[model samples]
Target chain A: MADWVDACATDDIEEEDVIRFDHGSRTFIIVRDHEDNYYCTDGLCTHEEVHLSDGLVVEATIECPKHSSIFDCTNGEVETPPACENLHTYPTKVENGRVFVEI
Target chain B: MPRDYDLLGADAKSAVANGLVTEDWYRTHLDRKTMKALMKRADQPAIWDTVVLFGSMIAFAGAAIALMPSWWSVPFWLSYGVLYGSAMDSRWHECGHGTAFKTRWMNRAVYQVACFCMIRDPHCWKFSHARHHSDTVIVGRDPEVAIMRPVVVVRMAANLVGLTDMWDGLKRMIRHTGGRILPDEADYMDPVFFAKTIRTARVWIVIYAATLAAALLLQSWIPVLLIGLPRLYGCWHMVLCGWLQHGGLADNVLDHRLNSRTVYLNPISRFIYWNMNYHVEHHMFPLVPYNKLPDLHEACKFDFPAPNTSFFDAYTEMLPALWRQRKDPDFHIRRQLPDTANPYHDGPARAAA
Candidate 1:
């Protein structure tokens, strides 16, 4: 059985922005792209464990605040150096003005 | 031999014990909104500047090559060198921080170009600079400390022509190409990036080898002139500005006010240096973009020592201090802050006067 947890209201995240969603023991970063599409990835930066939610969401990537290593919001693939590993992405869905992430 | 200046040396353990590593330094207070505004990234200014800089480099190189075998070529080469070797340093620095452009790819592209021009490995210097910001001027921690006290006059003189740094960079690149990470680099850098660092070094080696081959095939100095040799001649301005950054300032201090210097340079210098003349403010607020630095300086100047009126004024103060420090390693410029500013920590003994 898959767990789909309601992270936040879709309106809570503006276009091309990210918000940290803490659901019980799991933490996820929910991002809304410029087209209003949603994505879910591990909340912390793979480089230094800094919260990716605190970083900048530019274009389709999230730039880590600490070292500026960028990760693709779509697939959580690392697009830069200093961070070699790809982020674990979760399936995301929006229903009735709410964002849900399947973890 | 015990190299006390090495970041991974035994002194590094002492620095950690003394609470220097990763500790927060003193910062001037700015409202959150103001900070947010300053930290905002933009692409327009950086795009415009990059085009101008690269365009100028092309123009100068073209002129130099066209005028070759004539004395008229000298000025063109000189102009090319300053733009490539000297100005690229600031671009390398700002782009390394990833604050130069709003787009990540743009920043990365410029960083690679500037790194090659300056003969620095982007992967290595990136982490090194991050450590620099984390621990500025803290002896045994800051790898970028330009002057190790009881100043080595010979080394300093060599650096005036970029000899020391260029030689060091080439040697390190060669070592890195062999897939051998220095013990000191391994100390601060994460192990996972080591393989990538090695790969990057290999790529850089190939590019340099190709450049050399081009020069050999052409039987002209033009190829090396366009690539490696400029680092020696055009580097004077870079060395000049770099020395002023922390030359006569306090060392092993947590307060940037006590360690970093801020100078007012001419418009041309500011453009080339990317407003890093506001060095103290940049050190304190590393997230702020270069374009916003002047405004940030305006906001924070009340809490800082007055900016050195001009480069000449700064060098005048710094030269004498360096001369004195040759005999007294404890010697440093004690900048007087305005009354509104908070007093520096460990005040009495560290004050210059």
Candidate 2:
């Protein structure tokens, strides 16, 4: 069973941007790629705790500002270190243009 | 040669005896065949090791995320390991000197790996580190020894506290603040070389940045922070290792015997650090691999410049010793010319006067 949680409204997010959302006690970065797709990933970098929202989004890849650990924004797969671990992904979608993350 | 004689002559032995050599069960790097074989180990920059280094970090990051912890205190060991792995480029540097590898191309390849990993140009580092070795502690000449003044350290401290270490580091990327005076026959000093270095270094920075971005996309920021912050810490260690290893020690003009200082250190330090604690020996030969340092230390323990003066002692005793004076003392400073008994006044003089 999929448990979809309402994360944020459409107006809450800007285009081609990422915002860190605190779901429960844990934090995750919610990004809208250039394709206008919504994605949610663990907020902190796996290699270090630099905020992913603070990272640069080049196409589908998100680059950590600290130490340059890169990750695939869509699937949360690691591209490099100071990180080697894949980012845990939350199933996300948009309804009425509002982003929703499945826990 | 006798085993005992070989042992006695080896630097590793002195390293071991002094407790600076690490790894209890080390194959004594004595005898020509053994020496050659041990030296060959430098050639074994295995992809497996690199992969392991790469994979283990990923695995660690994953584990950290699964069992998510508080932000107040997070483990950042993996970051340190990543930094250490990158800094091992310095080791590749030693190899590039042809001290690590017998084959020149092999050494170049190793250096290239280091260059990519650290985001610094291998050729540039080779030239820089080489010059540093040739001119140890020659003020305004040696790039490595051109320590940031106390004021700079304070400025850097403010920047770090303000979360701008990276920014400050970035600013320094293009500027060559150190090494005002160039040595004679400076073969490596060229504009083209520096341009290439900057480009290579830029590529390195990009890769590192991309790696961080990937982690963020993967929702592994905690892991990146935990695993990556250690790199900064490791950089601190590198500085300490370099500074304490050579700083405030006997600074000689030409004589390796009278100039260098050796630390008779504990084995744990040597083991983790690969006998680099015996830095005097390293700077003297630069060809003797880490494994062979013990043997060399044993042979040259009683020779000039003395041995077994702990860096710890210098930190504890000498910090006050130097601090009391405010600037680095001329404890072992000497002049190359014939006029003065010692080129540097030994007992006491105004600091930096």
Best by TM-score: 1
- Scored on chain A only, each candidate's TM-score is 0.95, 0.88
**DockQ for each of the predicted structures, in order?**
0.22, 0.01
**Per-residue CA lDDT of candidate 2, range B40-118, in tens?**
3344533334455446656655555665665423353434344443345355555455544434466566567655434
Q: How close is candidate 2 to the true structure, as a TM-score?
A: 0.51
Once fitted onto the true fold, the runs of candidate 2 whose alpha carbons sit more than 4 angstroms away are: A1-103, B1-66, B70-73, B76-92, B101-106, B116-119, B146-169, B172-188, B215-229, B250-252, B257-259, B266-268, B309-311, B325-353
The CA lDDT at A64 in model 1 is 73
- Per candidate, chain B TM-score? 0.96, 0.63
What TM-score would every model get versus the actual structure? Answer: 0.83, 0.51
Off by over 4 Å in 1: A1-66, A69-103, B1-3, B345-353
Please name the candidate that would achieve the greatest lDDT relative to the true structure.
1
Chain A of model 1 scored by TM-score: 0.95
lDDT of candidates 1 onward, in order: 0.84, 0.51
